[model samples]
Target: MAQTSASPDVATRALPATWTTNLHLSSDTGLLQEGLDALEGYRKKDPNKVVVRFRAIGNAPIMRQNFYKITVSNRFQAVIQFLRKELGWKAGEPLYTYINMAFSPAPDDTVSNLFKSFATDGHLIVNYSTTAAWG
Candidate 1:
């Protein structure tokens, strides 16, 4: 089962610092598919456990983007490189994110709604804009 945060807000322990970059995966479905594929592949190779999610923020470019931050690990640099090179989630012009989850649940935490948050712990919150326009 997943672990919960100290706060009643229902969160998991933070992950080790992972990656930091950007992507063009818009807020749409088709493009999100590519982003998902890229990310999932990275997760498989990543030593530290991590997860990614997409929240529909209407149809604005700013809204369609995601915020990815190095939630918990120390190897932040390596992960960032992976995101830029291995994965095609490139950084964009004046990227910005508004993430706040110092307390996320474990991967199996009930408080996290079965990881519906796509954030088991502190995550690589990338405020990305995929070509799909809603990824």
Candidate 2:
């Protein structure tokens, strides 16, 4: 069968900034905590290696809701893959994302550069809304 050029029927509503910048990593809290524990293991195993962390962003840990943040002295790749590949998280879902790098300006900042790194760097902050997932 010949492949056809296709277009969507409607325009998509854009997500806010927070979703894109920091990585949410996992939708499930237990998994997120597991990842943190694994990081702790890494800290013990390789004390010399740079330490990275997935710290909770909001004041409370909201159930069934994605709310978190992460910090890395270096080695962003390690944590991104651990959550994205190993954990089998909310990836491939249409999730709302907000991205910025420490005081960077947004609102039409052209996130192509940011988007490239985010393929593996970003966290799954806000949980996936079905409309965002599959409208």
Candidate 3:
């Protein structure tokens, strides 16, 4: 089959003016600004006063209750230290901690920030195990 070029009249025909006007109006609207404001509100929360809940997993020993609260501003290392002291594990003993049983966070990461990003039902569910659950 031979190729044919479009007629000049058809090629010059423009999109309906209503469609162009609608596109320009939508782009100029402040929807993006509104979305950014909402996101800023969500991320600007106060982590210092947030309380995160810790729960033991597997055969890991429990100190008092099934769950306990810690301030969000505290470093993840504090939780590790507390668990070690509570379990009475030797200095060389190993313990593992994770959030939602998904992944372990860095020791320097702030508890409140983690809680803010991952908490469910207003509680940050932390799982601790004596053996490594994930690499």
Candidate 4:
């Protein structure tokens, strides 16, 4: 088969009249931007802080205070660090952390996103064990 380019006139005629008129944004931005403002309003804003509840899995030691308020911007690594600090575990010590007793989140995951996705009763339940607790 031979290849042929579409003529500019054919292409221009193919589009609806509204397409040509709306191609350049109007001075009244609202004309082209209607309903977009509502989309912005509907977006869920992330909280500044997220509540994290720590639970011991299996033989892991229990914390005197199990609840903590962590900044939303912090990563899951910060949670591990906080756990080590609270439990008096050294940096090199083995500490396994899980979310909601189900899965382990990556250390780089933002706390806010985790909280938003997996929080229960406004708390991010984090289960910790010195040894590998769950598969």
Model number with the top TM-score: 4
The candidate, 3 or 4, that scores higher on lDDT is: 4
State each candidate's clash count: 34, 14, 1, 0
For candidate 2, write residues 75-118 as lDDT tens digits.
33433434343234466743222333222223343223333344
Residues 16-128 of candidate 4 have per-residue lDDT tens digits of 68657666655777764876877776565655887899999988999999999998888899899989999999879899999998889999998988998999999999999
What are the lDDT figures for the candidates, one per model?
0.37, 0.36, 0.76, 0.86
lDDT score for residue 81 of model 1: 42
Better of 1 and 4 by lDDT: 4
lDDT accuracy of residue 113 in candidate 1: 33
Task: Please report the candidate that would top lDDT against the real structure.
Answer: 4
Q: Which stretches of candidate 4 lie over 4 Å from their true place?
A: 1-47
lDDT agreement of model 4 with the native: 0.86
lDDT of 3 by residue, 32-127 (tens): 798788899876645455545667778887767546567666888987887777778898787899999899999999887787789889877778
- Indicate the residue-level lDDT of 26 in model 4: 54
> In candidate 4, which residue pairs get closer than 3 Å at backbone N, Cα or C atoms, i.e. clash?
none
Query: Ten consecutive residues with minimal summed lDDT in candidate 3?
Result: 1-10
- Judge candidate 2 at residue 52 and give its lDDT: 25
Candidate 4 residue-pair clash tally:
0
* Candidate 2 positional error at 132, Å: 13
